[model samples]
Target: MTIKWEALLQVFGATLLVTVLVVTLFVIGIRALSDEKKGPAYASFAGCVAVVLYGLSLIVF
Candidate 1:
């Protein structure tokens, strides 16, 4: 069965999926880091934020 809003929902679904994946990866990454290696992880986090913003813009506009 197909719904009329499938196209809109596709964008929403992708955003939700990526959000979960990123959070899971970030949690694993943070846990795996040693005390001294956090700098790079934080940098990676900032990169993630950029990606999220871009995806958000796509879904929003």
Candidate 2:
């Protein structure tokens, strides 16, 4: 069977992009919380959590 190099690279690129995006979001949430700002901090944390859960759902289904 022949391997599809282009598809492989596309998937790899997408995975890398998503991983970076999620980690960046998590870091932003932590930084926001550390700064002791209430409204935005909570919003950031909630957003991070939502993204994480969405990722998990993608993996499961």
lDDT of each: 0.76, 0.82
Model 2 lDDT per residue over 1-61, tens place: 9999999999999889878887887777778778877777777667778878888999999
Model 2 clash pairs are none
* Worst lDDT 10-window in candidate 2: 36-45
Instruction: Name the regions of candidate 1 deviating beyond 4 angstroms.
Output: 1-3, 32-35, 59-61
Clashes of 1: 0
Candidate 1, residues 1-61, lDDT tens digits: the string is 8676988899799879988878876775576475557776777677678778887898799
lDDT of 2 at 26: 72
Local error of candidate 2 at 48, Å?
Answer: 2.8
**Top TM-score model:** 2
